[model samples]
Target: MATNPPSIFSDSRRKANRLRTLSLQAGISAPARFVLDDMVDDMAERLAFVRHEPEKVLVIGDYTGRMADEVLPHTASINAADLVGKHAIDLSRPFPVTGFDFVGVLGLLDTVNDLPGALIHLRQALAPGGMVIAMFAGSGSLPALRKAIYAAEPDRPAARMHPLVDTRAAAELLQRAGWKDPVVDSHDLTVRYRSMDRLIADLREQGLGNVLASPAPPLTRVGLDRARQAFMAEADEDGRVTETFSILTLSGRRSLAGT
Candidate 1:
């Protein structure tokens, strides 16, 4: 008998949120795509530095499609998607295809319930000596957002943020998944926002909005005011509050022998 992984996230909600964000980006004149930009830049830098040109590459959760555009000219073939296609793909399960020389994951792994299984599946989809790199928002991210949301419901704070994986745990998971020479790196992105609404809007633009299984109810009018006020408490002289976004990247290669 086979047991299913516990469901920590709502798959339907995740899909809806992703689709909505993509629509929001298409409609906006200049969407906030800092995280997607960061992922694309990271991948480009890595490929250039390694001097390893791959024949086939697979990219998942690339919201901007920049990854495909960036690597298409260099590689023989590239497969990229933001979870939309003829058939829906659930990353928590086994991948539909395998044997890619390189795999790049951006943003999606953070909300998966079975992260360890997902990591293992990523490795399994690779050919021998294939490399995998994944980047996501980690534990030390968004302190300002958390505090403000908490302040809105002083007596009973709802689960406004998803649980984040830290570097130590990510490294350990890679080791457990049997990745060779696994490496985990983290860097912070600081953004100054004049209001909480701007911050939330930006989050949606980047496909980083809420995907929790049982998300908190909409904030009441009074609650929203309190949250905005709390967010402004930490503002600088220019009336902009600085928020930190910690991006953690995990990388490793499969064994050459295809074990």
Candidate 2:
């Protein structure tokens, strides 16, 4: 039997703190608010296509705790969970509640060290024929930032970003985890920024910063100046550079055949 790989994340607690800090900052900024709203809106549209509305719904990474506001109208009950929030639930381990008719996981899978194991847990938590819809920052995101980081250090660039999953790989993992009727798709969202500092702040506020086990040390003053220059060199007519995020969404259902 093939054993699961060891965790690549810094720590569950560290991840939780990062999310908590972001959630607190989200209340004060609109850029931070867009990502969470985007996730919910997309989920809402997809849920509308289902033949029947889910009665018992569980929302993980409920960044703003307002997911219920949108879903509760159709669902009989909705529960929200996050690392540090009103509906607090740690996603690094098994979900605290199970047998839900549907699970909406927003922006949480991006940092999970054991995605296959997490999928298995989600499967076990669902009732027969129940569904799980998850979204995350996918592969090919933050190109400008990556390029600037590389340009900042010509000789030895350190690892700074998480290893994002591609659409094909995500689908394969869903199948490997035994999800029925698995589906995976991706869409791109681009935003223009005047400076790298603004982009970094937005990422931090959106809970999308680095969470690797051994993140690179803080950039030196020379590196920062070089990175900023590199980022600005890519600007357009309006003096703002465009950055793209490939958002990937996956939907899967538990088999109705057996538990």
Candidate 3:
């Protein structure tokens, strides 16, 4: 007998978070979408490096049309959407459309509960010899935040964060999904925060808020203070704590159904 994958993520919460985050980001003059911007730039460079001139493209999770703009020169048509919203896509399920020669996904894969299924569906949505580039925040991100949470609840700690995939696991997943010429690469970016509240707000604005299936209750006042103190304890003389986000890139092509 076969069983479905564990429901590690909550789709309803994820959608709500994305909508609220998008609204919050829209109000800011300079939104915190550095990861999305960086990923689009990297995808463009990779497309040029591979000499791939795709005529039909599908871009997911690029709400600002940045990725679509990058593909405009090479693609005759571009289908763009966020994970959930107007013109949204539910990547966790099978795709309705197919035959795109290029697919670029940004920022949404990490929250998916059935990642392998999603990856396989992505491949299925591509034409033969089609290229796919997907990027997301991976493991080793938010170490400072993680440590602070632990310090705040040393005993009977709650689960407030989503699990992220590591490079090794991502490689294995790509192979399992049968992508041809699959490649997995990662890079880190460092950001400094003045306070834990600001960091949390930034995360929420960037569509990285809590989407865990079983969200923890609000931290008590004492716990929040302890967490804040612990976070600031790691701050530099300038009174800003440094945080790291590791971005993972997965690139591949689908040459055949089996591959």
Candidate 4:
């Protein structure tokens, strides 16, 4: 029921083109390609729960063509596929689908402007008994960096290095979006970096840079210097800083009949 103008990044054509370009740049040894592989693996794991074989599948996030290609080579039930390679929240049009056996939304909920609306659309797009699997970054992500930044500038609001969805909040959203039998789980991955610069580079390469609403102004030279100092002070015995990434995975099925 909610609508908005499409974003350049979410447009399927643009996203596919971007992925194609990145694929070429990375060639056989591109680090960025691994991220897509991870996403595909997650989706495949979630799809394992569906009771019926999916003839038509919809993928509503980044892995688009890549995910289908990965699964298609191995599975034969997937006959038709469509991908909306944009923000799961701001789909350009209603998903023109019904009775799809499965829908996969990976790393999308956090970036959208309206999470509930997006889920509702996904529910409506599903056929009776269809399933959905989605994942997003969670609030506990980046505690070390958060602490370091807060120490450097206590007055500033906590920065969400990655838009994270609270587990409870996401489950509630799924229910509000009319999903049935929703289940949500979370896990954390802690990565170590030699310095803040290394961490920042990883963020940029992963396209996880800050895009929050009214985010703090760009980091000033002095601010960067102080942040580096704070990060160093908090480094572990091995002289490496750690950043946490909390991933929340959610799955649900649309009831055979509406309540």
- Write candidate 2's Cα lDDT for 170-192 as tens digits: 98999898999999998888889
Q: Residue 229 in model 2: shift from native, Å?
A: 0.9
- Global lDDT of model 4: 0.63
What candidate 4 gets wrong by more than 4 Å, as runs, is 1-29, 32-37, 49-52, 63-66, 72-89, 156-163
Candidate order by TM-score, highest to lowest?
A: 3, 1, 2, 4
Question: lDDT of all the models against the reference?
Answer: 0.87, 0.82, 0.87, 0.63
Task: Report the Cα lDDT for residue 110, model 2.
Answer: 80
Candidate 1, residue 67: the lDDT equals 76
Clashing pairs in 4: 10-86, 99-127
Best by lDDT: 3
Rank by lDDT (best first): 3, 1, 2, 4
Question: Where does the lowest 10-residue lDDT sum fall in candidate 4?
Answer: 79-88
lDDT of 3 by residue, 1-259 (tens): 9878899889899889888878877898887887777788888888889898888888898867876665556336888878666677888887878898899998899999889999999998899999899999999989999999988989988998878999999999999998999999999888999999988877877898789999999899999999999999999999999999898999898986635
The per-residue C-alpha lDDT of model 3 at residue 41 equals: 83
Of 2 and 4, the candidate ahead on TM-score is 2
The per-residue C-alpha lDDT of model 3 at residue 249 equals 94
Q: Estimate the TM-score for candidate 3.
A: 0.95
lDDT of 1 by residue, 143-237 (tens): 99999999999998898888899999999999999998899989998999999999998998887888888888998999889999999998999
